[model samples]
Target: MKGLFLDAVDELAAVFRHVARPGDPPMDVIERGEIRPEELPGLIAGYDFILDDHTALPTEAMRACAGLKHVIFLGTGARSYMNPEELADLGITVHTIKGYGDTAVAEHTIALMWAAARGLACMDAGMREGMWLRTEGVELTGKTIGLLGFGGIAAEVARIASGSGMRVLAWNRSPKAAPGVTFVDLDTLLAESHVLSVHLLLNDETRGFLSAERLAKLRPGAILVNTARAALVDKTAMLDALRSGHLRHAALDVFLTEPLPAGHVLTTLPNVTLSAHSAFRTPEASEKLLRMALDIACGL
Candidate 1:
């Protein structure tokens, strides 16, 4: 069946076109920048499938898309943008792609970890203001790093960090076995890790998973790197912890709000470094992602 590539940004649309080999399902591209929740039904009209990226499809609005049957979301965090079960009840199956950007994201995670450790962002900001900033950096070798969730991305991060001479630790809801990575309980991971990287998926149970109480348990002055969903942690508590210096730094790629509003509190904090949710934006990853999305669309 043919599909609509909704919210196709210029770069991603280019990737889709480059990867369009013969025999894939026909898909129309709409290079619309940012769609509101209220505008979804009309935009999605008459398509048998939708290739979605960064749009919230509220059930009420999606109920009006008469011919829609499938949504091939470009990333694994489909839950953050739409409720799969609710959409399924309306005969629209939400499908997400994973493992497409494991390396890209893992490399970004490592870079963020290094940047935070040495106050690289702070120094860069100072440099931009005509100041000669010589900031002391963190020596990552021999330091302990904790992975809050173990998945492909985390595994890649573990591989890179372990090779670079850091002690690696991981805690997952399900049991996992990775070479050179120590598996530990939540409290033990919290108490012992020098750098904690969050990789949990967002859902009802995982929403606000890192609460104030749990944040309190973390070893004070530890660095936090969250490439996962921002809803997984309590924003206010995280801000408080940063202000109080309980958290040495936070390198974030995801946020409670996308394009995190100007003058947001996180922006005001010097200890926090932000990326516009771009951990998975490399060309290799984008090519793989579109190829997978096309595969899902063809299957429908």
Candidate 2:
């Protein structure tokens, strides 16, 4: 089937070419920056399927594309950009790739956890501004880290944290087991964990899962690391927790808005560490992701 790689930035375009095989389905890559939802119909006119990377595909806009049958989202968080159920009603199937960047994202989760625990970003910014900032750092060796969801990414995170001598606790919606990890109920996980890392998928059931009441259950002074979706936690509640120092710190990779606006409240917070949702941008992960996307297209 003819396909288009919609919204492939230059870096992604390069990776796509690197992983393309000779016998693969015909696919064209559109090397451009972000496109508006209104531009969707024109760009995907004759494509049977499209490989989407961080683009918004409104059902209304997609309705105009008559021949499109499938959308192979480059990552698992397709719900952040489009309503899969709505698209399905339009006769379009949405496919998501998993485990492509598990290691990359897991390593990033650990890095953010450490950075927040140690106040690294605050000190770094202070140093850049001609001040010698020496902040007390948390020693993670004996800390307890709770994984909110047990998935491939969280499994890798549990392994790393366990190797570092940290106690690992996980709570998943369904039953799951992993070595060196203790499976606990949500309340126990919240009350005992010194560090809490969110790894849940964003969906109707899980959106704003960490509400004000739930955030209140966290151990006072606990650090939070989220490489998962932003909507998973209540934004106002998180801000209140951070501002009130109920939460020791928060390290975030995703946000309610992309390109988090200049002078945003989050940017102004000293207890917060922010990354541009780049936990899965490593070269190894990029190569694996594109290769897997191509593999999925072959199956389609």
TM-score result, candidate 2? 0.99
- What digit string (tens of lDDT, one per residue) describes model 1 on residues 162-206? 999999999999999999999999999999988999999888999
lDDT of each: 0.92, 0.95
Model 2, residue 264: displacement in angstroms? 0.9
Residue 19, candidate 1: how far off, in angstroms? 0.6
TM-scores for the candidates? 0.98, 0.99
Model 1 misplacement above 4 A: none
lDDT for 232 (candidate 1) = 94
Which residue segments of model 2 deviate by more than 4 Å?
Answer: none
Q: Where does candidate 2 clash, by residue pair?
A: none
Predicted structure with the largest TM-score when compared to the true one: 2
